[model samples]
Target: MYETIKWPDEMKPSRSPIHFTNELDVAASVETIWSLLTDPKAWPSFYPGVQHVQLLDGHARFGAGTRFETNLAGQDVHASVQEFEPMTRIAWGGYPKAAEHSRAYHAWIITPTANGCHLWTEETMRGPHWIELAKQAPDIYWLTHEKLLKDIAEVAVAREKSGA
Candidate 1:
């Protein structure tokens, strides 16, 4: 019984303050979902909007103190793995800078549920130019977040059907 997730209202309007979440019930188990979520190599394939991803340090396995680099919406983002609770949760946060604006903090969290899993991306943006950038690119961040959730869910379902 999978459910389609929606973007929260707080993330819609340009001036509403930065916050967003998306969740879906993947057909695969928590372990399967966790593998897909933490693997940097699969990110670009699954979430096409992610321009680039590279592990800066640490093993590919999830854990605190790991670091990674990502380019999202033309911004060069750097993040450190802040939390990793095995199959239960993973979170990372850091700053991302672009030519025009920057996000002070960007975070992604994954949580397991009885049926499947939940995923969310939240960013706190701060820059002298953010207000203007937000108005011009309202959907860039939020749309990418939504796409990530959808792609992971679909991949999990496919994996389950194939018995992988």
Candidate 2:
């Protein structure tokens, strides 16, 4: 069971920004998905285009108010937890460290289903150069997210087999 997260202004679909949402059903429990989602260290392992992640608070897992810095698509990103509800929803929003003048909010929702869980992630980016960035690589958004869910599902399935 789960509920949609109250998205921040930055993540709102109504806002003016390039927005995308992707989802997949996984044969893993909500707990399993949550474990992988909260662990910043696990992101680079499963998330596509993530080069590195540094948890600002020095915690292995992120909860409400946690901050982190990550390299995405070779660009530095500074972000903080925007919404965190254990086993259900998690989100963060921030800007690029460079002078791209872009900001975005990324959110994930995990809901239990008959087989396992449904994981959905959405992002909205807004800035002066947002259109140009999207134009540069239009396929990145869908392809990246599609890979992200598939990778997470594989990790979750492997974890189940390992009994970890």
Say which candidate scores most in lDDT: 2
Badly placed stretches (over 4 Å) of model 1 are 1-16, 97-101, 104-114, 129-131
> For residues 25-57, could you state the per-residue lDDT of candidate 2 as single tens digits?
999999999999998878877988787788888
List the RMSD of every prediction in angstroms: 6.0, 2.2
Query: lDDT of all the models against the reference?
Result: 0.62, 0.83
| Cα lDDT, model 1, residue 120 | 56
For every model shown, what is its TM-score relative to the native structure? 0.73, 0.92
Candidate 1 lDDT by residue in tens digits, 1-164 = 01221222332225436555555566567777777777887677677568667887757754677888887655677777765667655656555645334344444555667776666556555554455557898876667767777887788778778987
- Model 1 global lDDT (CA atoms, 0 to 1): 0.62
